[model samples]
Target: MSRFLYLDNAATTKTAPEVLEAMLPYFTEKFGNPSSVYQFAAENKTVVDEMRKIIAESLGAKSKEIYFTAGGSEADNWALKATAEAYQAKGRHIITTKIEHHAILHTAEYLERQGYEVTYLDVDEDGKVDLEELKAAIRPDTILISVMYANNEIGTVEPIREIGEIAHEHGILFHTDAVQAYGHLPINVDECYIDMLSASGHKLNGPKGIGFLYIRTGVKIRSFIHGGAQERKRRAGTENVPGIVGMGAAVKRAFDTMEERTAREKEVRDYLIRRVENEIPYCRLNGHRTDRLPNNANFSFQFIEGESLLIRLDMKGICASSGSACTSGSLDPSHVLLAIGLPHEIAHGSLRLTINEEISKEDVDYVVDSLKEIVEGLRNMSPLYEDFVKKQEKNV
Candidate 1:
């Protein structure tokens, strides 16, 4: 193909035109610090507050509960660190799953260094956390439970509502890193009993470097950032007026067209999954077949490295990922793939192709065909494939 076919929406999305339009005025005519008491800045402050309300409403939260941050990582860090510090008097234990994005996992690790106990719960083969195991892991002093709404790499949706109920029943706080699931999925914080939730704008066609943390009213958490009294003194720093405005526009558009977009994306996703598996030998689909995100299709092709496959796909003007964009340069196999019990070799060969509204049936077909050819060509040069073929022939 002459033009690029982007299939890595899971990592980030192209900023929507509407979102860009909404932000343009803020960068030019409306550029004013929201913290300033002057009349000129009042408009920017109003825009920030309005955007916060819109985001809060989308999550079924109060405007006061919404606090804007740099992005999902900052929100995740604040959620884990601030909550742990504030509630340490009550307890010091936290529960999280093994397959969370590094934002949550690494923050949990930081808490452990500070003498807090964290139980990293294991997931099943499909990357779904076991509710029974979660219940068993909760201790008398457990004060918080952090889990992602969905797996970023494998695209497995976790049982967030159930986990939230369990946390509330035990008088513990529940926080979910909804970076991958927020705009793509339907989320109502009240119904799920979530005390805290994190979302990034870039994941949903909004501007980068903007996101929010939803803290349910009455949740005791300290401020992570200390500076000017912004975000109602919960988060400090002059707000990114343009980014916030862009995020609000993006969130509105995403929710407005969510139903139709999800349906269409799922059709393309399923078609891609079926074609790739049917045409490619020794390729296995990762994550839950039906319960995963509507736009996600992850696979593992044997006897080849994921990086090489990704490079070949890139050569064909196809943009895909081996795993999370954050860990793209790492030599280690995906922690998420290993968490789901994939061996080192299989995990190394994993490929993640995430679709968006722009992806079409033709694009899916092209990708699958290109992938089949690439995998076959790479495997033909592999000693592993030759050995497996020889063993099979001898057995026959």
Candidate 2:
């Protein structure tokens, strides 16, 4: 078997060593409840506060603004449901993109059953929400707009600032699922006029099951969880002390090295794009050329199933993904690809390779070379391609 090449960083990244080091003590030496009033607990409490402070500072927010949760899904859930329930008096109408992660989309659906109205804004061919559609969606009843900062499958970044302005102009709250964009891209809640932002730690080389939601100072939201006095009584349950510590360390390390990391990742991403286009036949990139995530490279083969391509790459010890593994079991093409105006066949043939900050040129070259072969083999078996060829030949 060949050595594995992990390129699925978007799904999750290996926890950084520095982050692990920071979290170690919390699990053993300093394992005390942050709420405990004893001297022993005071030590851990101080650490949690520092973690909150640094994370908040990195996002240009106040320490109290950052509330930890169990990864992006929970944060997204809390942001939408909490705000909807609290602001139901104002209106039951909400706006979000059709391509939002299930965390937000499903929650919005659940809200509909509970008598809330939701307007799902459509995106353009590049997977960007149409600002005009968003503007038109707003009404006197509009209460909130929850658009993602960047797409998970296609990697297209949204016009969050514009969306925020639109929401505010209509007297509505704006939330962004920044799970994929927070650490990789600089995000200031104030700059984007963001009322709420969700970020996951594992996406930035921190411990899994730890995430934070940035709630603007005056944003009105009710608690979904109950029982504890934790999270300023906003969220309940015991604090994930070690996970919180690790997340802070990871956030600090990420932004500290952001520029260098961004440049390298972008270079590799563009190189992969160039190589696949320059080397493979009938390949088309799935997202915006320059308006996508720095580490995301998604493409569609002319006539191949994404699942089959994923397995081929996997057998070669190349860890890539077709779409979000969270939605892999579903035979339906990614809603993102479909929303971007891609034909069903094209959407089904998509491949996503999200790279690490450290993947070298050679690794990408190998993957590109392997892809060229795999796609050719897959295309050979494709009756559609064969028919296309025959039709072209007859026309000639």
Candidate 3:
């Protein structure tokens, strides 16, 4: 396409140039198995440890706490499943919100089938988990609480520190899927009382197929994969050296630019939200107004289908998402929207735009302008909209 505007950074981001540059040497000249005995390979192992230290420092954690995994999904699985097995003697119940990513939700389901109990907590309309409800959900058998740091669809930032405190108060382990909030927000594991966290490289402009699970020192969790003594025997398979280097570089770059980048993103994001609310008729903005990610703007246009709106935006060279990219292909409405008390029809009309620092006010204006036209055209063809308009005219 001659013109392209990518507003789907939540799905994935283009690897930053600096990250790619750092990774290039590893793929060619420095290619060596970190698990080998030779000096070349031993040096690679040192680099791996250094990358781990970088990731740890970002989270205020120790290098030994970070375990490399294939991606966020794997990390999430390892955190939940392994925690369950390790603590099964102590408890068999787990707690999580209804709006978590499928990686966590599906894993919870698997745990249920395996004879474990799970409590799916409710959230407010703004997608904030009810702290009181959380307190009530904690039983003696509740071993773990897994909540996402920030939502991928609506961009609602959860009360992570508070949740972590609650989990600790109950003497239970807490884990957060920080795939969306890692590079975008500031986090410190000790201050938050967080036992474990999962984050992905691709979400922060690093290479894909790489992620890390940070287990607090002395969590006593077993390995997810069984094989060679990679990741301190916590995870199997050879380390992705280039990916690790790229992730380290990306994390540092993200933090270095975060203050300025998110400040500008918030300014533009609020502008986009304001324009959409003022200009688009019958469209409702999702998520909290100010307590959300800097770049997330989600809206639900009444009497229009989300899929059709996405196609129209795509045709206009603007990319967005209906919900989470993982479930965009599915016809079902987002569980996140439903959990927040949205009706099925309204949820079906939802659109999520996660912009980057590069998106300007002008770009947002263009997107909002395009949205007005697309929503109007789609509503014209929708029988639901036709019926509603006829009733409105009769009342007038």
Best by lDDT: 3
TM-score of 2: 0.99
> Residue 249 of candidate 3: its Cα lDDT?
92
- Candidate with better lDDT, 2 vs 3: 3
Which 10 residues in a row give candidate 2 its minimum summed lDDT? 162-171
Clash pairs, candidate 3, are none
**Superposition error at 373 for model 3 (Å):** 0.7
The clash numbers for all candidates, in the given order, read 0, 0, 0
Tens-digit lDDT track for model 3 on 87-192?
A: 9999999999999999999999999999999999999999999999999999999999999999999999999999999999889999999999999999999999
Whole-model Cα lDDT per candidate?
0.93, 0.91, 0.95
Indicate whether candidate 1 or candidate 3 has the larger lDDT. Answer: 3
TM-score list, all predictions: 0.99, 0.99, 0.99
What tens-digit string does per-residue lDDT give for candidate 2 at 1-396?
Answer: 576899999999999999999999988988999999999998888889999999999989999999999999999999989998899988999999889999999999999999999999889888988899888888898888999999999899998888888777777899999999978998888888899999999999999999999999988897878989899999898899999999999999999999999999999999999999899978889888899999999998877899999998898889988788689799999898888888999888999999988899999988988988889999899999999889989999
Q: Write the residue-wise lDDT of candidate 1 on 208-310 in tens digits.
A: 9999999999998988999878888889988999999999999999999999999999999999998988888898999998889999999999999999999
